[model samples]
Target: MPATAPRRRLTAALAVTAALTMGVTACGGTTKDSAGKEGGATATGSADPKAPLKKGLTVAYLPKQVNNPYFTTADNGGKKAVEQLGSTYKEVGTSSGTDTSGQVSYVNTLTQQQADAIAVSAQDPGALCTALKQSMKNGVSVVTYDSDTNKDCRHVFVSQASAEDLGRTQIRLLAEQIGGKGEIAILSAAQTATNQNTWIEFMKDELKKPAYKDIKLVTTAYGDDDAQKSFQQTQGLLQEHPKLKGIVSPTTVGIKAAAQYLSGSRYKGKVKLTGLGTPNDMRAYVKNGTVEAFELWDPAQLGALAGHTAVALESGRITGAEGQKFKAGDMGTFTVGKDGVVLLGKPTVFDKSNIDEYDF
Candidate 1:
């Protein structure tokens, strides 16, 4: 990928403009603490931001699960970032995608291992808050990516795209697919997922717009990010709403599973489907005419951004404060925004004509 990719360039330009408008000073200095650990230095105070106890920090990435292609590609990006920074990297999680408690257990263990920082894609927002808060209290820098926990529980959140953008984009795509006047349903990952819930809210809000006034959202189903469960839920959606014109699944797992169910069913071409999906996962579906198009940000880029953010937090280059800037390897400098959130960029729409250009 080009260093000045369109998304990165746009984000960088916007970040610079926001920083100047906010009058936020760049605080990128480090100082040694009593324990000889390097920590971030505040611009106007003696207070030192916490940092790793050792150099070449260890960053543990805990996604919703292991072996899921979405997370696998994401973690691989993190691994590359860690390698470039000469940091120790480890990826750990449960095989069950929606196992919130299982993820908590992993957080506890990683905390016990004295990992320098933890980068996570939360399965459930509130379920992981207590564990993440405790991890932060244990001197571990917590960075949530993909799906966020409570804002107070983590240092920074690496968001793939703004919720409004993702939600509105999905709805617009579905509306176009269904001729802008039909009943559509949503197939989401987990009911408690923060990102999914937020995007769903925005989707509902987008439907209220005049352009989508003719479209009606029929129902929503939770797939728990499990292929079998998602497949069953897709079947249920079709069976319960035979006249449903389209379905939007904002999760990679759910979308792929929904596509599988649609491809093998009688409604293959009758009911339209569109949402956030990877090129590779939806390629066959697009080729078979089971799906027309979908949209998603690069998960690998999101992971790499998260990895760089974790390293910055652990190494004391930035304190996760608004306007703080840090270099994200080849992605360039990113500024922390309000609520300690860092936007990765915009989502990309993928279809048969250009799907082959992307591998992840």
Candidate 2:
């Protein structure tokens, strides 16, 4: 959540006068009810599509984590949208280290609060499917931002770019730094993550071209977005592959962890670090010489766009289709794809000269 609200006095009219004892729910969950629809858009007792979004129309944003500055920026974006739209939007999540259970609990809580809509940066597309499906069943409009959820449940996905673009950009960045011909290693997030897997596969295919054949990718490892684990993996790469010239981490946490480890070591200038990292996380590394450059999109803009798109869908303004343009406040106009998907644009390469200009 953005900031916790202290408990306050409640009028008797609004109070739970009769304290009915309910069983202890799971961590991060709320009391459940079964009288709701499954994956469809409309629910029986929900607010009408044309109903004006009032001041307290709650919209919840659940991200992969809350500690990274990237998600913080995204929260700020959602906040701006809330202010502009005069609605209630809360940004909440586990601390990057937790499993999918906490998010499940969060979804239950949103359902209890009867949120107007939910925008999530899903940790696992599969694990969160049941929870999201349940939420949608209970009259919540579901949208995924930064990352994605299972296709059947989510109404819209705010994509940052295609995996092909991400993988190609990282390879191009490393090749630019290492003169295009040397051994490279991939330090990825997890084995099952959809985004990372797709990007890595695209990177592998891109490397087989004539211009990139000279650039050999020696090894690949999973860091699971753990800082210490990523650091150890970086060290192991240095030890095991003496000729390794670069390491690419498709996940933000793994990229920053690897960059932090390389920034302080003798390999600072030797093995280059490039992947999907925020400007704040990699600012020092880019300025010092540990990383020549890295790639990422504006995640806050992504969240905000997702919020607007979900509202639009709820209001019957647009359907999920290719070439469908829509306005995203402060983030400018965006087009919808074949799957109600919206791209936030290409990966931006940040360096010393331009890093300080971007807050996220």
Candidate 3:
């Protein structure tokens, strides 16, 4: 169900008061109701779709974790976008990337603070639904990025890339490295991660293609997005499947950890690794031959897009409905897709040749 309308009215008033206390201007002008069917628009019944969100609204970005390099970089992008838009920007999250319970508490706190919007990378799609639903009802525009929450709980999801694209890319890369024929395994992040599961499902579908028939999937292991745990899991995979020739770790943490484990083992030159990873984290491994190539979207760009989406939702420039359009600052204009999702772009393949071109 959508957020309660009466509750949003109360929360909006409280948010305006909070904004005044902070010496920030609150949102003005009429806004469409939760159903996107009332108020807000010109005399001709049209809205200025490219207008910026109201100035001075507070936007809090809550990543999956605080210290993780990936989230840190992404949050920094969000901070830059928010500040540039003349809005208050704050970031808060758990130190452990896999802590869903901790993320819930943080969401509740942000809602209590009456933030204009809360952009988050959920640890689990379902675990944070209640808190996010409450946040939405409290007039906090909820936008999920990187990892998403349930559809009913958030206004929009800024996806890094299409699930089918990411899945096909990772498997195709692995197939090339493994000579298109060998036993391969998957080293995934959290088992319940919505994005991870979606990509993995598509990957499974891709493997069914005739070109990949020679490649056999040995097993899939969960890393929980922890370095130590992922490292240990990689070791376990090697031990359990001595003939494993390749590994696809779609999570940044898992990919880095798997590369580290492979770098020192007898499989250094034997086992091939590829997945979604930032160039910096995988640079050394790529140079030393532990990893040949991997794919990932620009995380900073993803974050900035999410930030822009949050503001757009709060300001009513565009409701989270399919075909609604809005401008996202320098990143250009975007249109809301099915299920309230906004795609950043396609993933870029990072290899030794192009790794130097990317700083993040």
Write model 1 residue lDDT over 226-344, tens digit each, in one string. 99999999999999998899999999999999999999999998999999888878989999999999988877788889989888776666666777777787787788888878999
Candidate 2, lDDT over the whole model: 0.71
Q: Once superposed on the true structure, which residue ranges of model 1 sit more than 4 Å away at CA?
A: 1-55
What's model 1's overall lDDT? 0.80
lDDT winner, 1 or 3: 3
Give the per-residue lDDT of model 3 (tens digit) for 284-359.
Answer: 9999999999989877778889889888887778667777888888788898888878898888888887787676
Q: How displaced is residue 15 in candidate 2, in Å?
A: 30
Please report how far candidate 2 places residue 311 from its true position, in Å: 2.4
Comparing candidate 2 with candidate 3, which one achieves the higher TM-score?
A: 3
Q: lDDT for model 3, on a 0 to 1 scale?
A: 0.81
- By lDDT, the better pick of 2 and 3 is 3
lDDT of 1 at 279: 82
Over the stretch 119-201, how does candidate 2's per-residue lDDT look in tens digits? 88777768788888877766677778877766776767888787679888898888888888889999987666667777888
TM of each candidate vs. truth? 0.86, 0.82, 0.87
